[model samples]
Target: MIEKVKGILAGLAFRLIALLTLGQISPILSACVIIERDGKILLIDRSDGLGYTIPGGIVHYSETVEQCVLREAREETGYDVLLTGFVGVYSSLKRDPRFRAVALAYQGQIVGGTEHGSGEGSTCWQAPGDVFGHMAFDCESMLKDYLSEHQRFS
Candidate 1:
């Protein structure tokens, strides 16, 4: 089917990009946000076949990490989010299989915009517990850390 082919092509593309840039490139800096509402979390079913990821992407050179988080959230999830708190920075070498990457994660609340999907993936709200094992590229780790931080405070 077309969707299957698309997934294959996307996975191949992701692998190729990773192989082509690995080690040759410096640490990839990206930002993501955790948005929880109505006892559910916002998630993306990635088109790259890289499993589920939160609303985020690589930080543009033109923007700060916070700005990247906000921009990525709006672009990928169709929601303008307000970052309420900083979760933590995740810099594990194996965080992303494609390359060594660093991430700035934040806790966000939806402010405006209509919900929809983009080229990255489809956005959906699901229980945090239901999504634990399906996350991609260290996203589960990010979520766990965010939950731990929030629980400690709340």
Candidate 2:
């Protein structure tokens, strides 16, 4: 309800701005946080039938990538997380269906807050293997890369 309204408003605003710029906008920049606890990872089922994905969203004009990831995590999953490290950047043009988007992926630890679902989806914690082959967007690749890197250090 509220999320849908926000999305509609944002779409209108973007369209208006695009008209002003003659539709010369670049790919959107977003951030996603990979929160891990006890060998499990947090995922959200994006009610749109897009399946599970890392908790994340577009980085607002006034916010940095770090701030975006933390804010998105809290908003979507009801968790307060502290970023532990950056995983990597995902910028494939085909990664998103609506538009080209570049996502900054980060690794974080849940420091506080209870888990809950947002208008966008329900939240759950799953083992990395369970999530690996069943994520939406390019999240599977991102998760695998992050896990592989972490395993090397562990």
Candidate 3:
């Protein structure tokens, strides 16, 4: 299954990251967007078995965070979204278990494209209140901050 493959790949990736970093606090910069439609938010049922994660991923060296957000949103969720507002930056040490990742969160709305899932996972829409415990990483925290209408730096 794809999930099993992801799990195996994730294990390898995690170990490789840890070894390369040598246990240093080398945080990765990434961007994500909360794309809303009809009062529901887009969520990815990640194939890595890490539960649901918002559509996002590590920023490439060639792109800005804003560009990365747009690219990642389209790649993961198969929807083109326009950034409406910024959610906040999430940089907690525990934000991700595989590696330290700083999330540059933003609010967005669907602008184009069809619905589909990438190698990341399938896409689903859910109410903010309905996605509490099923979320992975610091995604739940990110959503809470966004819903509360406040900027967060955790």
| C-alpha TM-scores of all predictions | 0.81, 0.82, 0.86
Ranking by TM-score: 3, 2, 1
Candidate 3 clashes: the total is 0
What does the lDDT come to for candidate 1? 0.81
Candidate number achieving the greatest lDDT relative to the actual structure: 3
Give Cα-based local distance difference scores for all models. Answer: 0.81, 0.83, 0.85
Model 2 residue runs over 4 Å out of place are 1-23, 150-154
Q: Write the per-residue lDDT of candidate 3 for residues 59-152, one digit (tens) a residue.
A: 9999999999999998988888999999998988788776667888999998999989988889999998888998998999888888889999
Per model, state how many residue pairs clash. Answer: 0, 0, 0
Estimate, for each residue in 1-154, the C-alpha lDDT of model 1 and write its tens digit. 4544664665566667777877355677888999998988899988767678888888999899999999999999989999999877788777876556788888999999999998877899988799888888888877887777752221
Candidate 2's TM-score reads 0.82
Provide C-alpha RMSD values for all models, in order.
4.5, 4.1, 2.3
Angstrom error of the Cα, residue 104, model 1: value is 0.6
| Model 3: lDDT to the true structure | 0.85
